[model samples]
Target chain A: MGLPPKRGDLILYSVLAVIFLASCAASGLLLFTARGGSDLVLEAVLDGKVVESVDMKSLKDESTIEIRAGGGINVLAAGPGGVKMISADCRGGDCLRMPAIDSNGDVIVCLPHRLIVRVRSRGPAKASPIDSMTY
Target chain B: MNEESSRGTMIRGPRKIGMIAVLSIVGVIGIFLIDTMDGARTVTRDGVAMNTVVSVTLVSAKPKPQLNAILDEIFALIGELDKKFSMWNEDSPLSEINRNAGISPSAADGDLYSVLETARRVAMLTDGAYDPTIGSVTRIWRDGTGEGRLPSSEDIASALPLVGCEGLKLTSGGEAYLERRGANIDLGGIAKGYALWSIRRLLREKGVGSALVNMGGDILAVGDGDGDRPWRIGIQSPSKDRGTPLCAVRAANTSIVTAGVYERRWEMEGREWTHIYDPSTGFPIEGDLLSATVISADPAEGDALSTAFMVIGPARSLDLLRILPGVDAIFVLDSDERGMEVLATPGVRDSLEMFDDEYRLTFVDVY
Candidate 1:
């Protein structure tokens, strides 16, 4: 038979158990709350068709993709951290003006070429409840 | 101490450990539940249609496969609509109608005929402010201004005569004809709204209680945003950056469409020219009003009125809104003294949440 634990021992074990449980809860929360950039998937669509879907985490080096559609050329650069339209022959060059998108739900559109590049997260992140914007 | 008491203390220590273990398990489960509370109930898909961005948001409890099928159907419908309405597409029904101008009547699809009929009605309602036959002039502006060259007076004069609704004739037998050789019909003003109107019916039929379909900037919101509250929509600011909204309105089961000169405007020779043209003048509209947003049950009406309001200016648009039932408008105008001013119809005035002091807001009385 083992010796009966002293009251001080019981108190120490109780405190340690509480601490362990609290840490477990906190770690679980952090696991869910932290947004992993690796989960981002970039989808490039041309003329209503999804032509390219690349996982950002899979690309170890920066690469450029040239998309020719609607008699226009749009150059897209995708790397580990983000994706952006580096250049486009489409009128107004609006796609070129758009900033690099790293976060989920970010979109870059070139209207003339009918090209849309957007980021989708394969995580538990919630989409905005606001329905739409009218401009 | 008694042996039994000593044994009880040892057992109590184990019990404490067991309770902690149980709590740790429960805590992990609770955290997981928090993470997946919504469980991806919202599905959003975006594509390109009608030469603009088309996005759909659906909220439902259905399994993901069913939801994905619903999204596929929606995009397919948009693609069909684009083929029927896009004038830029040389093979589109609208282009077919333009091709047969002064030559022969071209057969229009049933949907095309109905939309053209609606276009005629809107043109009459707005006193020719929303004429569909202004396509000739708009085409010239589209090509000329795109190259940073404004259309000459001679080009405007030639197209001006083609800008009347009388030139467009839609027969009950599903044939449409233009009276003049150069006359054209452009659905750019209302096609997106019509698309939204159809999408609304389709969503309702699919049992989607909450959805939002945005074709470019024309928005149709149904039910709640996320199955609980009205969908909050932002009205794009004319003077500020593109994503920055002047104000927001809570909408449910309604359509909000905005047309702005700032979207496709260019500065040349120290003058600014926009895409929205005045039917009578055959030139880009010049007025204090920079953008107009219309809210109504019918997306088509909202879409057409947003353009007509820009052509007629703020005062006349306010008068028209006072008489039009179930229709409200928000007009953004340039004020030399106030910088930017906003005039909103009474129906939407109470629902607006202003974002900044950059613009002065006034609620125009419908009475």
Candidate 2:
């Protein structure tokens, strides 16, 4: 029972259809690029700054990064799947006792050395609403 | 054809306007979605202060530089607080107070006074089970732990006389002093909690609605985390392997503190001595409980209570907790009969998710 469409209405429809297609194209491109080359990386942060990062994907044999900062020394060993604090001269030796970090969100901190060894994603950060452990 | 043309003109104006409105709304929504996905980012910063690792995680829509600045401010705040509270830092106000103990009242800042006030309140509530003046005994233990030997009974006895909260006098005008020359105050039990409480306030002042502040293993959750879910905080297991999670508790806008014998302990002569010293006994707490996790609005209170629970044992802790509102506790004890047992206050029984199968969880109904 409606009236027939006019020229202006056709123009509006054409504009909307173009925008929808463009949006789809852009989203598709984003997805493809975002998923292409993400690899895990191990980062060593000292005093809130990232001092070093090693691509975990390329890691083979164990490599140690000895950092002497914040009035102490820490040795970080990185292997295929993860990184661990092999040794630290901190008073409590708590850092050496910490478990190896195998995936993202795992962290090993040496308070005396002011060092943090963690795993991070090389790609864009994804939101993890999961956890914060309280000891 | 003529009739159809005339009707089309009559309705075409309203129909075109409606189409324009709908398209406009869709375009706006699309832009908003893009903005949210692109602009919102989670920023995390970590540093070491107060003899512990401090981590702050926040969700912000600000630019990179601004977010960095905010984090810088937080870390700086922690550093400043460290200088005020650290026992090892000789230039700290607390050290100055210790130096002037029994000789003269040391002028204190508002923050120091406030923390001491809380410490005093908790000391009274626990009836000397947890006292800030235990510094005398703590120092002996600290020295012993470093030297890889146990303090002699004579040393412990001499230090025990100095470990009394009654000697700690705090004036209302922001001054504090120990009544005896050798008496000392150690804020180790509650310092991290107070730091977290201060950090939470600072984050709110900086317009940060959501954050997770972790000092060592003590945590303060501000608002809902990403995805609008209450933050899941793992309660560390009281075992030889530290950082192992026994359970996870959902938290929002509150502080979680866990005091465990495993945190700071040393083995000598086939005996284990922990850091939770009893002011009356001048020795590590020898109780059924292994660790105590406290959930409260005030981190300092939770901190002190967790230590107090370790000293007073689970039976007395339950009695006190029954009357204390807005405070929940989880006690892990090695029962003589049961291998491992976990007990939680009524409030936390539901939010707790057990991760370790070896421990049994039970609810203590205060109601």
Candidate 3:
């Protein structure tokens, strides 16, 4: 039979086993608790006013909505999976380049046009509070 | 050989137990750290009040029901404040004082009395540039704007005599009276700021560590933002084309109040008329400045100062801001040569971040 494991070897193995299990548990919690539901609504606000809200859950087909305000226009697309700004007249193009928002509280802001597109829960899904509002 | 084996076995048993205990402690610590780093929670509620959209954001780990209850109380408090301060409310305390103008001193509530006192002091400091006794002029302008017309000069002149704050008398026992007939008081300029202070006080009393209150455009930050970051506030551009921010400021436990010509304006007969009026002339103040933002430890002061600065114009307002302690201001002006110019006090300059290249930033010396 092979030589018995030494004290140093046992200690190293025990520490490694603890770390592995801890990491696994952390990842599990993140995966299960952090994922948001698919039912989401997107609110388009212009000049601190809500102009329109499109429900992603109710949409059966992909469509685009154009908002014209303050001498600028922004086009937003809402699909079954998510919503995104497809086009805008502003110079920065930051809103257009923003990634698709699938979860609640994700915001796409066009500073030049003063337009904000934010995703929210459709039903009574738990709302995560924001720390502060800049406007 | 047997003795050696027994000694090794004894060492192994205790060592294994010690190892398990250490591992359990590590696991517990790791879990806590993960939860703390990733589980920071925030809740936001939005509603309409004071003829504007008000949003309250709170950072808490409390249950949803508890958080909802706190927000409900806040909203209800705002409603009550509206009833007390609104000039539109015929039964409001302010209306009662207005109706009893030049007749008798109306017994005011404790809060209303304090707010009026503060307004009187600010009006004196600004030399009537931020008078609360301009209710008659404001009423005419409101009606004119609603009808897409400008108030006639004769009407404005008639209202001017009653626009001075000196005509309003306040007693030591919370009694208020207007010394002149037709003189009225409108708290539109200062009421929002007072409401913000009230909200902050309520949140503090309720053990809320972090909160942001935004009533219309007036903002009050009570504590640190998420992850200890300062709250970032975007200053709206005065240009009508909207989307681009003129600048931004980071605030913590302070109030920011902005008075912009764009907030309330109407176009009639090829001219633009804003709602802000000069207490002296009883007409909208004419200036190149597009907006004035005031930052102060006191929200009420910030609110009143913003209107005062807007009325005082850029040069005189900058002078007044220098002498005022614990207050800062930013002025966005329409320059004839340059496209636009941003003049700010030292404190305001430090926190202001200008995003556009076309706009020039100038720092004014307080001393």
Candidate 4:
């Protein structure tokens, strides 16, 4: 039917398949990785002054909060296994993109906005989503 | 004969209706895509953007603003807008525009006209207290680097001649011109307020109930959050003392702006070189306390007035405030010797719930 349903369809299918394969491998790799947990403190500073700080070890599941300074803001998130930025006002969202930190010694930072996402476990960190998965 | 022909042609009503419905749905989707992709773009403000928890964007509303992203956007917009529209940026189209002045209309886009007009109006109302065309004065006393030094009396005097509201002109047809070559209208004095006005227009058109534009100390409050309780905005204490708040102001439908010497200044030769300049003398204001807060129906106007009062000083600020209507101010004069003496309009004092004995809160009410 009209040149066997167009060559474009075949190309789309192939591209999608490649993406699926890559994502599966990556997710598997992440899940299977070892989980390292520790205690971490995130301090948001402005003009070399610490405006706000949050201790991740004390948090159980998730905590969403906002802090404001002269011309900037720092957002924090703390979760059960580990803590990471769900969002921030900083220019680059690198802090948010720092992988799910299940370990205590991980630090996710946004330098431009003076933000830090630090993770530390009181005991030992559990296996992360990436750590648990295997290819 | 026409009736008979029409009667015979009248057929497939359901099919026509079905086709029309499909077309309508497709048209709606097309309009949505076009507007979302291009009509509404993510625009940031230039200069020192605020780290704000203000959840004001209607399109991206959750709760407790995602801080860093808004700051970045604000910062980027200011930078981008500056690069695009700076009259002094020599490399900018706006510089070419300023060069042309009376020769061209500065583009039909109207941003130049809007910013210039807003600046001029604010300058006039403040009686030279807040003059936008004081860039030359600010440039002379440049104090960022190692060689940062305050300009001499002659330097200020020369620039003072070039500084005034008279040098900025906006024609009736949305065309703006720099009346003088050295004269410049820095939106820095009025940009936040312009943004507040534009955002308010967008919100009203979209039927949004409440919004807050927090450009650091410059904040514009519109309506209510969740349709209940006024927005409790905190005025940062200009005190060097840590972990203490000056006071909080509650607003349902108004904009509040504060201009402080502590905001951005480099002390040189026992004098503070700040961005806010006094057109009368073409110099940074010397003051007692920390900041001057302006509350008004127009946020942009409020912003301009705040800077004007900061430059004029408190004693002279009283004379200037009286002639102005629907505008009030709170001057926190650093009473370092006598402590902090707050000179506020009756309205501004009423808003603060004073706590602790040492820190006094006052209100300035302008109806």
By TM-score, the candidates rank as 2, 1, 3, 4
> Can you give the TM-score per candidate against the true fold?
0.78, 0.84, 0.73, 0.59
lDDT of 4 by residue, B1-367 (tens): 5987565445434444455556655655554444334321222122222232222333223222433354444345544555655544687655665566445555524655666666778788777888777766766765323355556788778778777777666678766666666655555677666666666765665454555566545676767532334566665566533113465666667888888876656556776566677778776667674788787888778877788878777767777777777677777766657576666787655565443455655444433
Clashing pairs in 3: A111-B243, A111-B244, A112-B243, A112-B244, A113-B242, A113-B243, A114-B243, A129-B42, A129-B43
| Candidate 2 Cα errors over 4 Å, as ranges | A1-38, A71-73, A79-81, A89-92, A123-130, B1-40, B240-243
Model with the higher lDDT, candidate 3 or 4: 3
For candidate 2, write residues B304-348 as lDDT tens digits. Answer: 999999999888999988889999999999978866999998898
Model 2: CAPRI class = acceptable
Between candidates 2 and 4, the one scoring higher on lDDT is 2
Q: What would the per-residue lDDT of candidate 4 be over residues A46-87, giving only the tens digit for each residue?
A: 432445666754566767667664356656666664556676
Ranked by lDDT, the better of candidates 1 and 4 is 1
What range of 10 consecutive residues in model 3 chain B has the weakest lDDT sum?
Answer: B236-245
| C-alpha lDDT of candidate 2 relative to the true structure | 0.82
Model 2, residue A46: what's the lDDT?
87
Local lDDT at B299 for model 2: 96
**Candidate 2 lDDT over residue span A78-115, tens digit each:** 76646778888887777887887877767887776778
For candidate 4, the TM-score is 0.59
For model 3, report DockQ. 0.12
Which residue segments of model 3 deviate by more than 4 Å? A1-40, A43-135, B1-40, B240-243
Q: Go through the candidates in order and give the clash count of each.
A: 0, 0, 9, 54
